[model samples]
Target: MATPIPPPAVTVEEILAELDALDDPKMRAVNERHGNDIGVNLSQLRAIAKRLKTQLEFAQQLWATGDSQARLVAILISSPKKYTAEQLDTMLRETRVPKVHDWFINYILKKNPESESRRIPWMDDVDEFVASAGWALTSHAVAQRVENLKIAELLDAIEAEMKLAPDRLQWFMNECLASIGIHYPKYRARAIEIGERLEVLKDYPTPPNCTSPYAPIWIHEMVTRNEGASEVT
Candidate 1:
């Protein structure tokens, strides 16, 4: 009689551990491409992927060795985004089902090397649905990280036009002045007025004929408005 094939190797925990061991940059690249908003550190991403992959690999191995647990792969790829870490951990920690976790893991991590299609373990429609859903979730998350090239180009063109147009530049400066409470009319007028005032003050001797204007009460604030404004601004 023919002998029975041994059970498949590789556990969800082991896969997770292996993935976690990847270098920071590699893990970061993957996260930047597919991770949700969680922004998990590189180590964390690796660990998660490793655990997920182990389960996936084991399922594939079981199918190759004549097992029917391949049905479980449908659970993961069908709605990867819906599963939480706690749920995954709980399943792994408590799993008594043989090769089910492996099937699920294989479905998550496996791919056609020559084609973009992921194995559906079911009908073509199910595979297509899972692929579309997984990528939609992944892309939406990654989309935030990638620059919007069209909008960036539009902004750049607007900036370039501003540089070529003096009116826009002047308008921009005027708005900036308005924001800062700088009155343009008063600013220029005051400049000319100060010049005239300074010429008159220049005639005064450095040492004043009179002493402190306020007898020790407030020597500084007693200065003339023209002098005070000049000193402060």
Candidate 2:
């Protein structure tokens, strides 16, 4: 067998240079519209990540002092599996914008082995970002069909506290509710009942041929689609 090639040494300065090379004014404008504000595009970030390979320590250093672009790269490069809850908490504390929040949840928090352990407690956190991360992680768990989800507990939470959940967390909590209703057959009826009672996202606009985000309607549509898919298969 051929000898394994060693990964190149990547310094924070070198990573910054790559980000500097990839900055685009137009792309920054577009990203700003979506709440990213970071000048580097996803493709550029991914290319840099590919080039540098994984360096969790370096990534952490970059994230601590870097601009939005550097932070984005840090998220891309960091190993979620290695992150302690305290470290993750610090990152979540630093997150202010929606784009970075989205990336952290999808790329780091959701993928971590400790994600479920971190979710419910984070939801109880008063900090908006931490709570939002919790809801987002829960939504992800539901979508990925993780076993033994607490459907009754989730339903109870929705009924007792969803209406009063933090502003940033409402959307993800709504998503978690819909996901439970859609994926867990036994709890479908109760979830749907709660959705109807809560009516979250009832008036949210939906594009043509798109399902509304209203939990009851969203759950019904997903279940229907799943049944149709099963029949065809």
Candidate 3:
């Protein structure tokens, strides 16, 4: 039989050094403004992750280092299915950087089997970040139209609390509203009305040619885009 080649050496220190080597001051400044203290070009970080391949143990070690850039790499390498729900929850709690927190929710938690189960409890969590994750999950669910989501109850909660929600939590809540307005035709009018009334993120700076994040405008823009694409086909 042919001999199998050994896996390449990998360590947290080496990965940290690699991340440091890729860091950019301009990127770091932009990230810091958005609550991420460390910034390595995400494309470069993704390349490092692709080279390492998926290793849950190595990913965990990187996560433990608590460097935002390292955690981004960790998120890229980690398997959502390998983690217990409790461990995922703990990781979410420990994620203090905005970029890292967003990536964990987007790349890991969204793929986890326990995601739907965690949604309500997390939505109610006292911690803003955790609650934001819950809302993020909820927004995903809304877009996917997952069963038994209590749509009326969601709109009710948004109508009642979204105006006063902390910034991070409020962003996700706004997302959920936009998702509902964009996806569910029956509730579309109500969603738009709610969004206009609250005006959450209405004045949020949008780059040239980018749709606004103001829920009402976002709902309209996305709905129009989807319709146009449908017509093209």
lDDT of 3 by residue, 83-142 (tens): 988998899999888888899999999999887788899999999999999999999999
TM-score of 3: 0.94
Question: What TM-score, over all chains together, does every model reach?
Answer: 0.18, 0.86, 0.94
Lowest lDDT 10-mer window, candidate 3? 2-11
Cα shift from native, residue 68, model 3 (Å): 1.1
Off by over 4 Å in 1: 1-4, 8-10, 34-233
lDDT of each: 0.32, 0.83, 0.91
lDDT of 1 by residue, 1-233 (tens): 99855434655445334433533565445544642112235344434434444344354333343222222422332344344444333333332332343334334322222112221111122232333222322222222332332323322322333233343222322222221112222233332233233221223333554532121111122324436788899
TM-score of 2: 0.86
Q: Model 3 misses residue 103 by how many Å?
A: 0.5
Tens-place lDDT per residue, model 2, 1-233, is 99966568867788788778888999888878877777877887888777767789888888987477788778888898899888888888899878788888988987778777888899889887888888888888887887887778877887888887766788888888999888888888888888788877889999999999899999999899999999999
Question: CA shift at 122, candidate 3, in angstroms?
Answer: 0.2
Q: Which ten residues in a row have the lowest lDDT in candidate 2?
A: 4-13
